[model samples]
Target: MNKIATIDTRLWQLGIMAILLLLGVLKRDFSLLPSQIALTFISGLLTQTLFIKFLNIKKYSFLSTIITCFGLCLLLRSANLWVHPVVAYLAIASKFTLRPFGKHLFNPANLGVILGISFFPETWITSGQWGADLTTALWLIAAGFFVARNAQRLDITAYFLMCYAGIFIIIRILWYGYPLAVFFHQFQNGALLLFAFFMISDPMTIPHKRIGRFIHAILVAVLAYIWQYWLYWNQGIIWGLFFATFLVPLWNILFLAPAYQWQPLSGDSNV
Candidate 1:
């Protein structure tokens, strides 16, 4: 048998996302057609391939493209079939156009989702679409944790979740006298958990240094809380991450670390 060590973190992420997509479609009414999913992958991969060829860049990988497509499928909602493919194309295109210091500036799926909702008001994300089921939330947390661990970015996810939860507890329960159950109930949100683990934890877009990642996580959490609670805006987490990404280049300059690679180096495990 082949050694399990040969697998890439991207492969693990792809498997986990595939399972989540299947579960969402089969059980949660994900509001996407099979054809739409197919179109997303096809368009995303094709865009990546064309960009690689057009730029004459050798040794390009499609793993990121696949992950972006799955993310878009999981988060983005649309009334037309063209929206998925178009967004997928634009997402992949940004990887090439938006690079600063040889790294992609924004998380591809996050940018795509933000642009989709911003430009096309009809296209929106359903944060509670997966329903607040304890069993499902637990499963997502476990699976997402495993994936984040494999990717060597679990610290950011942990910090973000803790900080975000702390803000909610302090404001909603203690400051406002809301019931403690309300604090616990917030954990049942599948979208919030998914965003914490999958979207914001993307290794490529995040800062390379540990301190940078932690500071970035705290900034995102605080911004998300203010946007959602204080400003009465929806999808605060998504918008928070989007805005915080603009500072990534500055972080990289101040605290430099090696860029993350999905494929493991010769004897190293973490990438």
Candidate 2:
């Protein structure tokens, strides 16, 4: 196979997520506990394995579980240890159970974040885990853009960023008296970059067609803006993606395309 088709993009995701977790723990003073991290992986792995066996699904693989575990460790913070494992379990379980139109409706990590924040009072998301440092922001954008490019989902990432930044500029900057620096500062947020590159770029959950992906990105941006700006709520992006997930089936219906499937690398037997 050509090098492009030989690459496993999920490996890049895992490596980057591991780096983020390490950075958060060592530099950002994240509240993520060791026990929580351990349990999160164990729960996700076991859940994925069980579902694969019982459901007779030979198509799914373990990289998605590992990626989800890393995402949980990076984005989720909880005072309670059990919250991590439970959310991890449900997130993986949702992949098997929540298939609408033969495709998973929500990104597993995204769903895990939603569950943690919604069901557990002590759980929360930490944008500060990656921090607003200039170097860090640049690194995040560069790394994420590279990953999205390799996965051929750079269009969706670009569209989402453009729509989100445009909304901020037109409404919050040009319309109001806010400085352009404010816009730049908000883009420095790590959570937004992570969501754009990793969660939304997942081939399994997003739309299969180009136009559908474009519209989906717009929906996510608009819904997130409504939640944060109009409704006066925090973590709008997370909730925005959650509500937007319901319409994925609609996108598939309107667009009439096959669901995305991972193209396994050459000389690799796992499917």
Candidate 3:
């Protein structure tokens, strides 16, 4: 309820970047650092600036929380200065225009990337998960477990994972001649891991009830699988998340549900 300030949110933003930096270094991919930092900083700035200047939602704490998630993605993946900002702006606009009852109906980041990919053929593709490789994927999975556990969103996470895997397995087995190889390749993707952990589990956009979380996660996973396998959408995870975000608020509205809440992790009250 207080005005968001640089001091209040900066640490979380930095922490996200630090995690990405650590992953990048571990992968020996130093080239990604600048882009990662710039993308994250810019995305956070754009979202915060919009919220402060237009929405007047100046609670520094909430703004910082928003920044932390986006910043972490930047660290995970390098983005081009030219395109990311434009796309990110569209996302912010979507939030302001499409929101219901002062809450965005969809995840802003997902909205940006999915729309950019769908409408602008020229837009390039970049994913934070892809930057970290297998090691990052494992770390992300672990992170997802902890986050899901802390948030009490594990049912959602589990439903998401199972539904996605189920759809993928079915598609691979039926359509692809080389199910063995193609199926194995799916597991190798970093973007999928990232989505499963950080993107979909965002405490802000998802529902809190155990049943709601389960249904929401399952829906996102199913949609993601359909987008990727059946629809041949290149940005599968982005599309899945975008649609999921859009649906969550509506689901809450219709069901009169509460948004999920997580107390800070056991050791980290600061969060």
**Each prediction's whole-model lDDT (CA):** 0.87, 0.84, 0.57
Q: Show the colliding residue pairs in model 1.
A: none
> What is the lDDT for 140 in model 2?
89
Which residue segments of model 2 deviate by more than 4 Å? 1-5, 266-271
TM-score of each: 0.94, 0.95, 0.72
Per-residue lDDT over 46-118 for candidate 1, one digit per residue giving the tens place of the 0 to 100 score: 9988988898876667777888999999999999888999999999899999887877898999999999998
Tens-digit lDDT track of model 2 for 1-271: 3675457888878888899888888888898888999999999999988987897865566888899999989889999989999999999899888877766788999999998999897989876566677888899889887677677655888889999999999999999879999998899988889888888777777777889889999999999999999999888888988998899888888887766656564223122
Higher-ranked by lDDT: 2 or 3: 2
Model 3: ten consecutive residues of lowest lDDT: 262-271
Q: lDDT value for candidate 3?
A: 0.57
Top-lDDT structure, candidate number? 1
TM-score of 3: 0.72
Residue 219 displacement in candidate 1 (angstroms): 0.8
lDDT (10s digit) by residue, model 3, range 73-160? 4422333445555565566666557757655566666666666566664554554335434665676677556445544454665777
